[model samples]
Target: MAELSDGVAIRTITFSLLSSPGLFFTFLTIHYIYRSYLFPYLQPSMSPAHIGVAIFALSFQITNGIAIGGWLGSYGPTTSSNWAKHDLSVYLGTAIWALGLGLNVWHDDILRSIRRRRGVVEKGSGEKVYEIPTGGLFEYVFFPHYFTEWVEWAGWWIVGGVACPPARIFLVNEIATMLPRALQGKRWYVSRFGEKKCEGKKAVVPGLI
Candidate 1:
């Protein structure tokens, strides 16, 4: 096997370490899409607008993966003794990302279970109405999955270093999109179940907004 630093520049190693989580998340998304077939109860018909949004989202993910990966791989590995220290942030970030991924998957499973248990089906216009999920992270936040996703990308940005332009941009985009979406979801949940059921839960954050 080739040595870890063989043919890889120090900067490349740093960049790769930072960028690896993005690629991992991209692959995880693909895996989720592939495995979606196993969960027929969770699938819903897509409207033209929904399809457009899906395509755009997928394209953006692909582009983000490419940009980060390409930038990292542009240089070769170097024979540097300081690689371990440089990789500290990467390792920490990966751990956080993994935690977030687990939470996201678990929350999704809970949502799916709720839908199946309630025999939820799509309406004539492809609308799905789900009961309030009060289990798992949903007990704390109205949109725990989205919150975990933000945590995952926050880890990504940390791994890439806060100064890295691409990572910063991605983090900004996530905040801009997810925050509003979570707020809207919170509103919808309150409207459905009234504020009593959602008494203690925040929109995305647990203790703070």
Candidate 2:
């Protein structure tokens, strides 16, 4: 029910737009546009469960976005200079977001290139298969993308501050979903290639989990 002053609201929105989550969301929109529409990559035919999960994921992001905006709008400006007010946390979040996005894109490129080299193609069933990625973060984590995503959200939470309820909600939801998926990916890899091949790799986090 608390509302920021008009001037404070304008400054907050401006800062938020220039921050990590905003930049990442912009990049993600473009990335998906290219991946889903412009690229000639074979699309996976989604199962019903997959569709449901995708919907839920999209919905969650939208809800989190709204919540974050509302939370920011309720907070007053901390300093006269807008940049100085959010400098540290915003910059930290941006760095983490950039790293995560880079790693995710790099990993995907590796997977796609490997599939191409192996002559893997989509079947009539609309399923494409890829070999296990072995370099970079993949060398340590079974699902490096997932791990990076968590790191990105951690940065977002840091910028949003612990006092923001919506920020906490986003962090918790992300971990709950991504952790399970990372574990599932690990299991799949183990089942396909045997435990010997995946012996040293952790599920999502390195060495800790």
Q: Please provide TM-scores, in order, for all candidate models, with all chains considered together.
A: 0.70, 0.70
Tell me the lDDT of model 2 at 41.
46
**True-vs-predicted CA distance for residue 97, candidate 1, Å:** 1.0
lDDT tens per residue, model 1, 70-152: 54444221323333444676677767767876787788778767665544455444765668787887878888888887787
Give the per-residue lDDT of model 2 (tens digit) for 1-209.
33265544344344444554454345445545655674444422322557777798788778866765565454423333643566676677667756776676676665556666554455443675556788878888877767776676676555554455775677688789788888888899899989898888899888877
lDDT of candidates 1 onward, in order: 0.65, 0.64
Instruction: Report the number of clashing residue pairs per model.
Output: 7, 0
In model 2, pairs of residues that clash are none
lDDT value, candidate 1, whole model: 0.65
